[model samples]
Target chain A: MKIVFIFLISILSVAAQLTLMPHLSFLAATPNLILASVLAWAIWRPEDKKEWFILIPILLFDLVAGQPFGLITLSLCLVFFCLEELGLIIFKQNDLPAVFSLTFLGIVLFELFQVLLSRLFAVWHLMEPIRLTAFYFYGSLPFNLLLNGALSLLFLWALNKSKIFQNNGPLAKLK
Target chain B: MKDIDKSKWIKFFIVLAVILLLIFFNFRGLLSAPKSWALFAASPFLKLFQVMDKGVSGSWAFFLAIKDLNKENAGLKSENQFLFEEVTRLKEVARENELLRQQIGIGQAEQQRLVMAEVIGYNPTLGQYILIDKGAKDGITVDLAVVAANNFLVGRVAEVNANFSKVLLISDSDSLVNAITQDTRISGVVKGNHGLGVLMEMIPIDAQVAVGETVLTSGLNETIAKNLIVGRVEEVIKKESDIFQSATIKAAVEFDKLEQVFILFP
Candidate 1:
């Protein structure tokens, strides 16, 4: 069932890339659905011992997209673990602040991670124009937050409707 | 409970094995291995996706056709007038050369090798990269310059395979080119600012840099030919106590509208 969910998320991410987000760029920023989905899964199933599932899509993203290897994987893992710990505190409720804060942190960390890796690799000079980086971060922050927040809520909603949120075991009780 | 624990370990082992295989392939650089089989397997689905995207773009284009047609018509009329004037100017130059007994130096340089390529697809996940139809077999190599119509430098080849090559646009974060002002001879490095625009850095603070000046490649590296059209200076920035000024460049080539490019062979 987790495998099926991962496949569905992958298809949705590809579809979003092809259709919904074509030419929708905020200064070079686009919606990161794969990142969002992986975060969602990490938060949804914190105790599943299936961290590799999160790593799979990230590896595929790096491979198919031609980014430096392990870049997205590293970022996603960091975001996943951070959010998974945060998820422990907020697990009882699906409130707006919890969702928005987590999504916002995800975006910030993802961008920071990319910049840090690029700097460490000597891909681009650091201390270049801060305006460009500032514009991209401030410009895309709200939209990314909203998009990821909606996705997180939707995932939580689905799990709740399916009774997975109420179950404390590996398998959710069927309705 | 013991059986459940055993099953969990088995599942974990399977997942771990898959991850290990992926990591091995990634480190080996085999993740980008020839995609002949995968392309064959996924062709049908890709075709469907293409059709859907085309349908969406087509509908939008249809709605805006009238406005676009009028703009195109106006552009063509001015271009025709400019061409007529250019023809007369060329004729005058030829006549003067004949009268002065001076040899016309036309066609003395090495033959220009151009390979025409179509951009069949782009990776949306990778915002600053594009794939062209021509590849290593066609003499495309890493760092080869790519230009659009009217000889505007668009990007350089970043990755090459048998039949396809990827061009990294100037808008990418990693792109940096040595460029100079066409009018003032002021030199600087044009670096991609990732999102807002490209910035020309390290220009001496005393240089008379102005907005709207044309920037061209300096050919300092011998990788990009001299005087290639890079961009137009949009803004000049000066900070107090700084020894150098930076300028923002508006790239001449619009990367978003790119459909075809000419890859220049070394």
Candidate 2:
């Protein structure tokens, strides 16, 4: 039942990401809700094997909106693992600051991985090469990081207030 | 601890293997069936969210406009009276023009067959695209021209499934349309500026371009029709050292707010 609920939430997130988020753009980039939600879920329920659960939306997003499939899934999966390792090493406590840091690093690595893989795909004659313009690094990235960071923090706060972290949930044990 | 590390490595390999398999299937065109089925199931949800978005945005816009409602209402009444007279005159002129064309044996230069489609989704990533309800079943194909009201150029169909298609907005980095200034007839190629806006480039340095000149498709591209309004020149950039000049275009169609569009059939 939990798996099914996650699956449904993933579908709604993808749909909202597509239909609604574009209208809410700041600095020509919209906040990545799926990325923020996944990162927050990882921190909130780390023991539940949430990394694998995160792949549900990742796959749906890839199928629906991704061009040249597997780029997003590959980048995000690697980002997920990196976040896990970082959480274990540094952020032993799942605090709000830790959420911000993890989200910022996750978004940065996501962009880096996508750029590198897209170049590789171009070399293999699978797609056209994307030019790394100055606007991307200087203009868009800062706004994207800011938006995702705020969103992830918001999601974490909501999770903290919700029942999932209270009675009959995993975080109840911690409390 | 050592066993935990080993298990983590195993999970990583499992992810990598699954991604590789999916990539192979995607590139081989084997994933389209499942993808279509998934999208077909999700289309209703997309449309529902679209309606919700529209209601929210519409209410927000109304709230913003409320402060100036009285002044704008008074001004619009006068403007509407003038426009009513102007429209009556134009209707008569159009009727005369139709008779003259009939006498000249020119039955309309072109009869465009347009299939109307409702927007269902948008691209979630950086690339600019909108998903529509019409698809191959409705005769939508790659490179077909999509337009909004007043014959404003939107973009072309980039991909199609059985029940849906993706329209690459004119603001997409990969989009290019051959266009010209409507009055001066100075030719240029209009391309997207990283999804932020559109830019018309490759104009001869000597061409006398001005701000606010209307840009139209040149019909140089076979897929897109001629004289469709792309945008107006908002700013001009000319450099002494550069071989060609370029101008920033304000697109007539708001790519973000599009709800319905007509796909042109050739």
Candidate 3:
């Protein structure tokens, strides 16, 4: 059942990323809703899932987004692992400010990884790393972080209402 | 027993290892088969979305025209009459030009193979690419140059699936074209300017060039042909003591207005 929910979210996000973003894109950057949702899940949910759930979406994004196969998957997995550690050591779960901060950091890391990795692995990415990095940080940070927050809130709400996160559910014992 | 069970971190690591292997295979061209299936699955939704988007935009345009119908109709009537007279004069001039060309023994260039396509998707994060509806099934392979209205170079087909392909616009950071100034013949390499515009770099500092001079492909390379208008020089950036100079460019095609493009298979 949870797998079904994850699959739905992944497909919808990929579809939206491909079909809807061009109409709404400004300055060539848009908030990545799937990245935010998965980061939120990694930070807020217990560490048992290991973001194995998001691997499908990352792989799908690779194929559809025209990025090098496995680049985003690797980056998302690394982000998931880092978020797990950050949650364990500092932020912990259920903290609003922490969640927000995590979302911001997650986006930073996500874009940074993408840009740097594209420069390294992908064909023909010669845009100055500093300029691309600065655009995301200065030009897009506020709008994207807000959107990421809203998406995280929706994910949190959905996870909260799910029976799997409820008492006597599979995750409850892990919690 | 539970303590001896495999940990999630271990599981995650295992997946990461597999992904890394796939990345290695990607460099070997081994990962394309699975990716083709993914593209095949996504193509239907992209087609549906393109249809719906066109419908919505078309209706919006209709209402927008309705708002200005009276004002535009009055102007269009006079413009139509002027265009009809101008076209008649231009046709006579064209006939004379063709005669002169024949006398000089210049003939039309060979017909180029073209495949028309519709813009179906754009992903800015993937370093500036748009998905077009025509693909391998439509004879669009990689490295074919795409042109918009007036033969303006829009991009080149980067990746192709069965029913869809991705065009990497010249405005993308990774894109490079060998270009020269049309008026002065100052040559340089044009690169995408952070997805906002393009930059012509690697020109010698002493070269004479001016803003608004046309830049066209030098045809020094096999990927893109010669004499295709790239952009008009927007800004000339010259620095003393620097070996090379650069210019900002404004591409001719209005990308936001792009809907149809032709792929030059030749």
Q: lDDT by residue for model 3 over B1-266, one digit each (tens)?
A: 34423465677779878887877787676766676667666667766766777788779889888989999999999989998998999999989988998999999656777888987667776577887878788877888888886778888888777677788889987788899999899999998875778999999999988998999989875767778888999999999989999999999876655778999866
lDDT of 2 by residue, A16-115 (tens): 8988888877656688888787667666643444457788888988887777778878888888888887888788786767767787888888888888
Better of 1 and 3 by TM-score: 3
Residue pairs in clash, model 2? none
All candidates: TM-score of chain A = 0.68, 0.86, 0.75
TM-score, B chain alone, candidates in order: 0.74, 0.85, 0.75
Candidate achieving higher lDDT, 2 or 3: 2
Model 2 complex DockQ against the native: 0.64
Poorest lDDT segment (10 consecutive residues) of candidate 3 chain A: A122-131
**Would candidate 2 be rated incorrect, acceptable, medium or high by CAPRI criteria?**
medium
Task: Show the lowest summed lDDT stretch of 10 residues, model 1 chain B.
Answer: B34-43
Q: TM-score for candidate 3, please give it.
A: 0.79
DockQ of 1: 0.21
- lDDT score for residue A59 of model 1: 55
* Candidate 3: C-alpha lDDT: 0.75
CAPRI level of candidate 1: incorrect
What do the candidate models score in CA lDDT, each in turn? 0.65, 0.84, 0.75
